[model samples]
Target: MDASPLRDPTIGTGAAAGGPAPGRVVIDARALSLTFDTADGVVHALSDVDLTVREGEFVSFIGPSGCGKTTLLRVIADLERATGGSITVDGVAPAEARTQRLYGYVFQAPALLPWRNVLANVTLPLEIFGMDKASRLEHARRNLDLVNLAGFEKKFPWQLSGGMQQRASIARALSFDPKLLLMDEPFGALDEIVRDKLNEQLLKLWAETAKTVVFVTHSIPEAVFLSTKIVVMSPRPGRIIDVIDCDLPADRTLEIRETAQFLAIAHRVREGLRAGHSYDD
Candidate 1:
């Protein structure tokens, strides 16, 4: 399967801005905090954090190391339980959401199997769930097209560039069309050029699919570029310092960064981060 644009190139942008929320609170985290009972006493990874994401919205959490951005994401995904607070998805517990496969989780790496071709990699989840072979292949093909990788479906993971591989990984995540997309530093390892392109494509994908997104990242510009809301956090006890709404237009391009409005918002987010901020130079 090879991908082609489904509608007008701009078709993907409207759903992100025009549609009413899908009427689902995809993630609700109230006073979320986590602590590990280590021999050296407790290490507080997060404290008193509150966040709520409606379906089809793109939200990003940005903070310094030890500020618990990843910790919060893990808690919401139910990979780690909160030492305090609550998380609900579709009015159900995070564990229930996990068991029902109500979301897709993307880690820092592409994590594609080395031996599998792109189509095969995307089909892996279906196999695990015991989906029928014909349906599995059909779903995988549609997903590959969704990510604009139909032509590369037969290529092995190693043959593709980093950006392509990550796109394939994202395709796999979307094959089931999970309601929420949980991303932890998905673009962290790529170069600036590759990262920017991926960010644009991801925004387009989100707009088209209307999937709720909760992304964790350390980069302020990255947060500012893709998020409707930016949650900034402080270190030590790891508390959220501020939640800033981004008022930029949804039709973002690299040129948007050069605009004053974009820089201004990014600046404010940095101020919220304060001493732990990156890119002060």
Candidate 2:
């Protein structure tokens, strides 16, 4: 399906004079650390890390491989436990926030079931929540439409192209209407053309849904383009190297990426990555 805006424009300035506006802190971390114990000895994945994501913000985590970009995301999702320090989602601990279903996660791959059609796949979570069939179907249909997958509801995963499958994954994530959306390199595997298209669509989705998004990406351009705030991390024992607040206008087109402002931000991200490498050396 072609990329298109799913709903009326709903983009709003994320925060005002003070920090995060009142009651808008969606994800907060302080001196967060994680370490792994193996027979080979101890490995520190994260150290003294801190981050805060406000409501209606699009935040991207960028770093080199094994930099703990994904690990940090998993920490927020409560999929992985931190060995030390603290982190919270919506004012509660990660585990507690998870129980409250405060967020939805989209992995690197679509990870959709082969047997379930698009609609069924999107509705799976609602079904798990024991929502009535009528309500679940309605919710699924709405989300599918939001992803521009309305006509493909009856198609199976294998029947959809990689980009479409990822869109379905997004639809699935939105079905529950979670306040936060955490995407881990959702378009990393697609061809450049497809990836660019999905990126455009994702921005539109973010604007319309007005949900806080935490995305993980290795692409500097992608991170610079999509993030309202970009968090750069260092290698092993991942530590936040920089947190850049993007100053671009909310209503942006792909063409904006060619402008000096976009290039400047991208350069800063590049510098942060280079600095990380220097620290490692």
Quick one: best TM-score, which candidate? 2
Question: Where does candidate 2 clash, by residue pair?
Answer: none
Model 1 worst lDDT window (10 residues): 1-10
Cα-based lDDT at residue 30, candidate 1: 89
Put down candidate 1 lDDT per residue, 55-171, tens digits, no spaces: 556889999888889988888889999888887986789899998988888889999999999999999989998999999899999988888899998899999999899899999
Task: Please name the candidate that would achieve the greatest lDDT relative to the true structure.
Answer: 2
TM-score per prediction, in order, is 0.89, 0.91
As a whole number from 0 to 100, the lDDT of residue 42 in candidate 1 is 94
lDDT score, candidate 2: 0.87
What do the candidate models score in CA lDDT, each in turn? 0.83, 0.87
> What's the CA error at residue 79 for candidate 1, in Å?
0.6
lDDT of 2 at 241: 96
User: Model 1: residues >4 Å from true position, as ranges?
Assistant: 1-23, 275-281
